[model samples]
Target: MGIVIIGSLNMDMVVRTSRAPEAGETLFGQAFALSPGGKGANQAAAAARLGAEVTMIGRVGKDGFGRELLEVMRQEGVHTDYIGQSETQATGVASIVVDEEGENRIIVVPGANLEMGREDIAALEPVIRQAEMVVMQLETDLSMCEQAASMAHSHGIPVILNPAPARVLTDELLQHVAYLTPNETEAGILAGMAVNSIADAEQAARLLLQKGVENIIVTLGSKGALIVNHAGSRHIPGFPVQAVDTVAAGDSFNGALAYQLTSGKTLTEAVRFANAVGALAVGKQGAIPSLPQLAEVEQFLKESARP
Candidate 1:
């Protein structure tokens, strides 16, 4: 298996407006779109779009949203046989608002996603064991994330954990993660510091590394990414693009990084490719809709390499 993503699946309800509304103040939206998203699902789709064979393991409600989510995954070529259906919980959903600047604010309701339990992971053991790499996120139950990471770690499979929604994670989970991809804010929270620049990111990543993460990649949006390992750190500059929406940019990076790493690219090269992938993702809208296919990514990289 190429990549196995164990996390959440949600339908995104997005509205475009000039900016986020003030407290109790509503504004007229410019547009709206319903898109399939969930950190796990997004990463899976992003990798698949880049020519990686991906598999998804998560839960969705036994509703229309669930059906559509699974169907969409199938359309993206993600293996969805391991995805479970929740009996009591509704499918997860995200309420998002995009501004004229392409910035977005989101609130996620994790319904069926939280229903994923240890038993479900047990049932999915064979699939997990077969993966060349395991991708995960914090959108699901923290216990489930830890369990999956532990399982893959024991089997000597590399694990890429996207600590989103910003939480201070336990070392138990960090030790198992081969790659911990956190945004600037996430890195700050994890290290009990304020990360506002490359220097700050380096310090935060070092602190996080002491927590036992094999490596840390701090995504600094347009500034690029900082790679921190036992050997120290290096910053890979980002590819500038006309960002229509920043949604899924980090997911796109994680997926592309996993793809390139498993394909034998070095960490620096993988991050560079992932940066290009993220640049492509931000130029569009929605989550899955923003991911670029392999040819597009190749062409983008080819063009970017020009003088």
Candidate 2:
């Protein structure tokens, strides 16, 4: 079964600095690069590169960036029949700064992404109906996200919501999600409790599970990821690597998880595979371009084999 991604596509402009800037301090950046990115596009590319058939549903502008973004997705083998072009706005854009420690701060200008509506989602009903898993992110319109979740749920397809750029999700929405993947901060927001350790992560996941989600995964950066289901919880440690730019690690993890899930792997097994994919992602630079392919991930896993 294929994976469907409904989210944003943007031209990402990133700069690397020695440290993040203070409230009003100016910091010197060591390098910069422009890449094709957006949470949806990134995850789609990641899954596609790992051998999953991915269909992307989103909107872009009738601009150069929009054209290039579509071309990039096509090159990555992502099905873009549902992606549309908006005449009223430009494609989305993100300005990101990565500090020496691999932490990032970003500001996104959602152009055509915001233009996506119920009509756009309705057009993808056929595609969503055939998919085994539908992955969504918070970068697009909340209404669109909710609609996609609802549509996928109606089809009995599993919906995975990566609550990045964390926002409040209603109980109705949570009830439709098969899995909720969040970072520590997002876990705290959703759980309404502090998530400072693996124990806390378990508690937070349980809290979300009680809200109707079947499972929850809390990503703890270097501490790896915490996977929680009715069975129990486990901490999947991250692969050791020197991170360069961590811009797409989370996206990679989500994509990898969807791929494994659609392949019929158990949730715990998928989390392990995603943890490895995410660790490999941090060892590279840039988004889209840095996403590891199936072979690359295999090689990394082979070399990092444990006793």
Candidate 3:
């Protein structure tokens, strides 16, 4: 089965700063760049680069950013037949700042992204039904996410939910999610517990499993990621690299995990592979531009495999 990505596509404006700006304080940026981004688009690009036949279902606008974003996706080999254009609004946009510590802060304007409705999902039912895995993020409308999850579940396809920019998700949403990938902050939000360490993350994961999520993957940044299943929990350590930008690392991890999982690898193997992918992602610049290809990932893995 192929991979279906139901999410958002946006133009990202990024700036580099020495530190995060204080409240009511403005700081001059060292550099600025524009790129094609959005959690959905990032993940789709990541998967496609990792050799997955990825189909993206999202909306753009009748704007220059939309045109450029679509062209970028096409160049990356993602199927964009389901991606639409809206005349009523501009495409989504994300304003991001990367700090000296490689950390980032972002603000998103969900223009046409928020307007994706059940109708959009219904139109993609046929494609969704044939997918091995359907991946989604919280960048789009919650109603659209729920609809896509419900439709995929009905066809017995596994659904992977990346509940980023975390919010209170319903039990119904969790029930349909075969895999829930959340960062530490998002885990705490959904599990209603403080997650500061691997142990704390494990506890939060258990709470989410009890809440009906079949499995949970909690991202721990430089500490790597924690993969939890019915059998047990394991921490997949991240590779050490001088990070240039941490932006889109989580999205890379999620996409890599989805690609490997659908390729018939075990959860642990998939997570280990994803950890390497994420490590490589952060050591580079830009969002979609930083995603490593399958050959690059394999070479890195092989190099790291040696003494």
Per-residue lDDT of model 2, residues 63-89, tens digit only: 999999999999999999889999899
lDDT of each residue in 229-255, candidate 3, tens digit only: 788888988888888999889999989
Each candidate structure's count of clashing pairs = 0, 0, 0
In model 3, where is the ten-residue run with the lowest total lDDT? 115-124
Per-residue lDDT value at 146 in model 3: 93
Q: Which residue pairs in candidate 2 have backbone atoms (N, alpha carbon, C) closer than 3 angstroms, thus clashing? A: none
TM-score (all chains, Cα) for each model: 0.99, 0.97, 0.98
Deviation in angstroms for 26 in model 2? 1.9
C-alpha displacement of 273 in model 2, angstroms?
A: 0.9
Q: Give the alpha carbon lDDT tens digit for every residue of 215-300 in model 1.
A: 99999999899999999889999988888999899999999999999899999999999999999999999999999999998999
The Cα local distance difference test for each model comes to: 0.93, 0.91, 0.93
Put the candidates in lDDT order, highest first.
Answer: 3, 1, 2
Ranking by TM-score: 1, 3, 2
TM-score of 1: 0.99
